[model samples]
Target: MSELAGREVRFRNTDIALMLVAVLPALGVGGYGHLMLGIEILDKGEPDFSLFGVAKTLSAIVAALGIVLVGAQLRGRNATSIPPLVLRSLSGSMLFLLATALAVILVPRSLNHFVRELQPLSVLTEVVLVGALVFLVLSVSSAWRTGLGTLMGINGSVIHALLSGAVFLILMEETSWGQHWIGFGTPEAFKGNLQNETNLHNFYTYRFELVYYSTAVLAFVLLPAFWPKRLPQMLSQLGYYVPPTWFALFALPVCGLMYESWNIIPYQIWFFCGLLTAVVIGRNDTKLRMAALIQAALLMLSQLVFLTLGHNMEDGYELSEVREFFISVLIAGYALITWRRATGEGASASST
Candidate 1:
């Protein structure tokens, strides 16, 4: 549980969620998926696969460090204050943001106005800065050790959410840096981004840049307050009944739409199904464990099904490959759920 979502929502968790939710609608659309896959296959494009791809590679390093630090704390490695760790992370975050801000203001003006005129550079910048800010706050949260070590777990999820959301956005925006560009607020930004989507030579992540703004505002405000506690509790509550058998949900909205032959219906169904089922499933501690097991199993099953089916299909047709590394999470979630079910603690009420 400590390695997964925290016992409660914590800092930056909100930022990641808000960022992901905004794009999910587009990412889930069959048309969009097809378009993206086609680009990847036809254009021979790639995800950041770099050993240092900020999204995948570097995140893993931070996770390992954080996890080791967390474990050490648990096993009585608290000779140093967790607050300092949090502060260090936060301070680094602030420095990065300030430098980015300065670069946006000073650097772009030096380039030709035409470069500014045609590039979707500014909005791309927002994705990086916003993500960085979210992490900055989350890394330094005060409740890092609160709630039965739940805060650490929640912090991890918040980190995942933030990192995950950032990767998704970077994939949308063609510019890797996501720094400020010409035309900070204008129609040209949108037009430029749409144009960039077709040039498979360069990858662009977000399609509608304005959508990014609203998402940033939401994550910045609400997520930091509850990301550490809310998401885990909610998932824990969901486990009370639904069982993490979420792979059942992969085609959730997409296939739903295809079957109904109506564009909006499938997504609407997915939204409600996912939301409602999560609520109805959880009842008490014992059930939460069962739910975790099923959910973990679902992840395994989903990945297995995807690979099995994916191998047979042509490229771009496979269900999303959101995780190149999910097996570890599968094991961890299952083990924790099992441990909790075996024990009689958590959520203040008795389940047995």
Candidate 2:
């Protein structure tokens, strides 16, 4: 009984500490949002360099912290069990939503310009894509490091090369390889469709979307599901090597598609594909299977909420965006915990 009590205390302390760590980013996002709101409310439409600088600085810090925390979690063996991790991540997500609410209260029309540019969401999409790129690069590196590259065969090598090239292209286009930051001039032919002076997506219109969707379907869905015996053996082996949670990473881009088009087809495809993948790969692991199923259901619910009630909530605060953002955060958080578990198991299996 004494040992049990001590364990409970330690668990509670750990939960509190995790909550604090998660809140740091929420605070930074809220602070930046508040400053931006003030600028819009007071200065009409003019950009305030001082406030913008502060906000950018805060966002950078938050991004850095997020990366560091995720890295630590990946490398360390100190994570709580799944139930606790889920609860803590959900709590952290709620806190993040609360911070967004505070920012909304500070300035009602804070998201107006942001909505026009589809900012933050756009940024989030880029970040996810970049993350996928990193994952693929690391996977390729791991395959080579383990001498699994020799076993990949010609078909597998071709697929790997294709995926690598595609990911690199997408990442470059998303960031414009720092061209946006450096204020590179847009071409005369491309000026009309620009989202802003910096972004080319408004002009391009779904060019990369097709690329991403097709590649995702090919690499993650079709090959694994249909070609399981022949060409995709190496790909399937690759999937087994990585965390099962990685399978859900494709959902991010699909969600972005839903947000942009407000179409239910993307959501349908997302749900079905997620269900299929879960059923196919999670034959052995109940936890991973359940995680995939839950992710799909939650994603569907988010879409339903956004479609049914989002417009009604868009009076001043852009509650729709806020809701969608929080939902995405929750999904990502859930995925991270599951990924850790899956990878940890994989590591243990490999060692044995």
> Which structure among the candidates has the greatest TM-score?
2
Per-model lDDT: 0.29, 0.40
Using alpha carbons, what is the TM-score of model 1? 0.24
**Which tens-of-lDDT digit does each residue in 10-51 have in candidate 2?**
224554466467446545544545675542211111112365
- Candidate 1 lDDT by residue in tens digits, 305-352: 332233333332111211101211222222233233223232222111
Q: What is candidate 2's local distance difference test score? A: 0.40
- For every candidate, C-alpha RMSD to the true structure in Å: 20.1, 18.1
Please list the residue runs of candidate 1 whose C-alpha ends up more than 4 Å from where it truly belongs after superposition. 1-83, 100-108, 111-207, 226-352
Show model 2 residue runs off by greater than 4 Å: 1-145, 151-164, 192-204, 210-246, 249-267, 272-285, 289-293, 312-352
